[model samples]
Target chain A: MESNTVISIQNLVKRFPVGGDFFTALKNVDLKLHKGEFTGLIGPSGSGKTTLLNIIGGLDSASEGTVRVLDQSLDNTTHNERAKLRRKYMGFIFQSYNLLPVYTVFENIELPLILNKIDQANRIKRVNQAIEWVGLTNKRNSKPNMLSGGECQRTAIARALVHEPVLVMADEPTANLDAENSHNIMRILTKLNNELDTSFVFATHDEKIMGYLKRIIRLEDGNIINDKKIKKEDV
Target chain B: MLFKIALKNLLGAKLRTFLNVFVTAISFFMIIFMTGLYDGMRQHAKQVTIDTEIAGGAYWHPLYDPMEPILFEDSHSTLPQDIRSLVEKNKAVPILVSQAAIYPNGRIMPVIMKGIDPGQNIVNMPTNTLNNNKDINIPVLIGKGMANNAKLNVGDSFTIRWLDSDGTYDADEGTVVHIMDTENFKLDIGHIWIPIKKAQEMLAMKDEVTYVSYAIGEKKVKKSDGWIHRDVNYLIQDIEAAIEADKPSIQIMFTILLSLAAMGIFNAQVLSIFRRGKEIGTLMALGMTRAKVVGLFTLEGGINAILASALTVFPFGIILWWTAKHGVPMPMDYTEMGFMIAKRLMPIYSFGLIITTTILVFSIVIIVSYLPSRRIAKMKPTDALRGKTGI
Candidate 1:
């Protein structure tokens, strides 16, 4: 593993149990993600893109190969250790904008910092800054139910960036948004990615999302078919 | 931090939280109130029995057993010099008990005849009433219960029959001089009281008595000759035993109330976990360990007890406080039940009772809360995020 590598996966295999048999999700996959890189696992549903992303995020385990994120191997770690890894160095965003519905935007953004046991003054300051970065300062005190889809997705992005984690894994982040909201969210995420120098891995098949990725790994039938790097001008 | 999250979740639940807390508060109040009432009954019964019948303590004849009325004939003995000295000094009162019957209104009713010194003021019984009606064949002091049963009022005459020490039956016309009302049913129901001298002359049991009762707070003496000195606690065993026998029903009630409250909390926790699987998964995703998640839910449940305790301060607490201050009026007369219960029973809420009740209810809430929350430990974060039910 290089010092710049945020995630290193070697021949990773993940399986789920079917009736008296096993259904493989990711098959003998090899991948490496570096710091400050904007990458996406581009695939349709059931192409194992989400499975690979979950393995790298330490939310799920590999059955056969080693997955190391930020110098820690996921295979040997306990559930509590995995939680600590996510708590200290990783953030997550879901397509559904999984911000806790009962919490206000500021509270949702402050959750990671709270889990990190940051002091109250620091938490408030960082949460306010993240809210500003997402252009949601006016809606910071509004709960998710009160926010538009775009605003809710912005809050999720703010939460994923509030702790300045080394890695952020987003799955179908813009699946539920319109083209305008999708672009707006991608723009905010791209700005935060550059500003924070955070590594980002997105699993999505959306063309709008693909345009924003500097590197794209395409998967088909649980296997990677192409891995390519592109410049912003090429899109 | 955990407390803050738990409280937020509970408050966010709104009506569900209120309903659980209300049930818990009701259980808490009912337990304390019922226990306090029982305590009041015990204390009142003990105190009144001591004041009216047992006094401070007594010296009982070796053969005396209050439950065995057949032994009353053989349970009498001439007082020892030491006890006689106490009676002479007005520090004690001697009583002779015998099994007898009364004929009133053409009814043959059995009874117990007690002989006490008319001038003795050691006990609260109105024995001085026997001193009146010197011209009557026998001026007897009957309690309200005996008088009511015999249909004999003051100055009414009835035929009393009893066996003498020689085993010969004798009869006399007894006039009721007074009907005294007392809480101690042992000294009231189906009992007749006559002056010791007249009773001794009539029964041919000269200078012999059953037991001697010392004045209230009198120093207890060691056993003299064949006599047994019974302490106040020993003498009050019947009342205590009666109360102890009735405790199981109260215990069953407590179990039901506590179960209802616990069940409410348990159901709420189950529903919270089931409905908020995504939220739980999200929390785990953000780095909360499953144990912490369980603690969070358990704390939510435990907070019901805290909130219930706070809720108890309104209505429940006020009602308890008012009842403590000015006794609860019993629905019916309990004098005939022979239990020395006051008309308005005062509740005694001891410090120990309150502390024990709080800890008990709090622990139950925590346990029920934790029982359902344990499912979080077995849940796969991915499955939870997909809104899959673990239980």
Candidate 2:
């Protein structure tokens, strides 16, 4: 693996058990993600984009082949080790804004910092900064139930980035948002990617997200069909 | 981090958490209260027996058994020189017990005739009433129970018949001089007390007694001329044994109470884990180990115990304190059932009992909480994230 590569996957295959038989989810997936890259895996449902993202995020294991994320081989790592890796270096944003419903916006954003065992003083400062970055400073004390769809997604984004992780894997982050909220969310994520030099990998099929990605990998039927890089001026 | 989340979850649960805590607090209070009642009964019974009948101890003839009234005829003997000296000094009191019958209202009723020294004050009894009475021939002292049973009040006269030392029957006219209201039923029901001289003369048993009860603070008579020395513990063993025999029933009650509380917590935990699978997935996604998740839930249960203990202090504590101050009014007198329990039973709480019950309930709560949490370890994060986990 090169020094600039954040994730290196070679012939990665994932399968699930379905009634005494194997159902292939990802077929011989070969991919490499570099630092400071804005990438998206654009595919329809059942195309195995989420499965590949889960494998790279260390949430799932490959059935065969090796997956190296941030200079560590994820093929044989224990569950605790995977959790530690995710805690220290990775962030994840789900489509439905999976913020803990019991916690306020500020507390939800502060979760990753707390999990990382960051000092209280720093946690407060970082959580406030993340809230400001997401333009949710006024709604910091509001619980998830009280927030609008855009606000909830913003809180989830702030929570994902509070620790300034090297990699952020978002699975259809704007799926539940309107076109306006989708564009707004994509702009914030793009701004964060450029400012912090963080690598972003998203599994999405929304056309609104295509304009922000510097690289797009298309998949069909558990296999990658196209890989293309676009210039920033093309948008 | 675990404590904060657990506390937040409990607070979010609102009424569910309160219900579980309330049930646990109730269990805690009931166990302590019932145990205290039993302790109070045993202590009160022992103290009364020591003050009235047993005194410090007793030296009984070898064949004497209080439970066996049929053997009373063969359980009498003359006191030794040492015991006689103690009796002369008022440090001991001699008692003569014999199987006899009384003719009351033209009916033959079996009874135990006991002779006690009227002048000796070693035991708390109304024996002095039998001394120096010219109005009645044989002045007999009976208890309220015996009076009630015989339908004879004070100053009532009846015929007393007994067997002599030579196996000859004799009869005499006896008068109930004073009916004493005492708590010790052994000295009451179906027994009559007379002056020692009159008893000896009527029974032809010259200087013979059934047992010698020594005064409180008197040294144990090492040589009693082949008599058995019965201590206070031995004398009160029947009451203790009776209380012990009834413990299992109370234990069953405790188990039911504890199980009720434990089952409530267990059900709550199961529902919480099942409902919060998405939250669990998010936590694990943000990097919490399954063990920590399990600990978080278990700590939630522990906090339930803690909150229950707090509740026990507020409302339950006041109830317990009031009961300890003013006794619990029993529906009926227990003395009639041959138990030494008083009419108004007082509860006695001990430090050891409180600590033990607290630990026992807390431990059960934690265990039940953890039992449902072990499922978290088997849950797949992907399945949980999708809210697809079965249980």
Candidates in order have lDDT scores of 0.87, 0.88
lDDT of 1 by residue, B242-305 (tens): 7788789767766776677667656765776678888888888888888998898888888888
lDDT of 2: 0.88
TM-score of each: 0.86, 0.84
lDDT of 2 by residue, B1-391 (tens): 8897789878876887887788778878888888788777777777778888989889999999988988988998899888888899999999999989999888889999999999989889978999988877789999877888889988888999999888999899999999987778878888999998888888888899999999888887757788888888788788768668867966776677667756765676577667778888888899888898789878988999999999988899999999888989888755545666677778888898789789988998888778766686558788778876585
Candidate 2 Cα errors over 4 Å, as ranges = A205-210, B1-20, B61-63, B74-94, B102-109, B115-161, B164-208, B221-228, B239-265, B302-307, B313-315
lDDT of 1 by residue, A103-193 (tens): 8898889888988999999999999999999999999889888999999999999998899999999999999999999999899888888
TM-score of chain B of 1: 0.84
Each model's RMSD to truth, in Å? Answer: 3.7, 4.0
lDDT string, candidate 2, A112-185, tens digits:
99888899999999999999999998999899999999999999999999999999999999999999999999
Name the top lDDT candidate. 2
Clashing residue pairs for model 2: none
lDDT of 2 at A84: 92
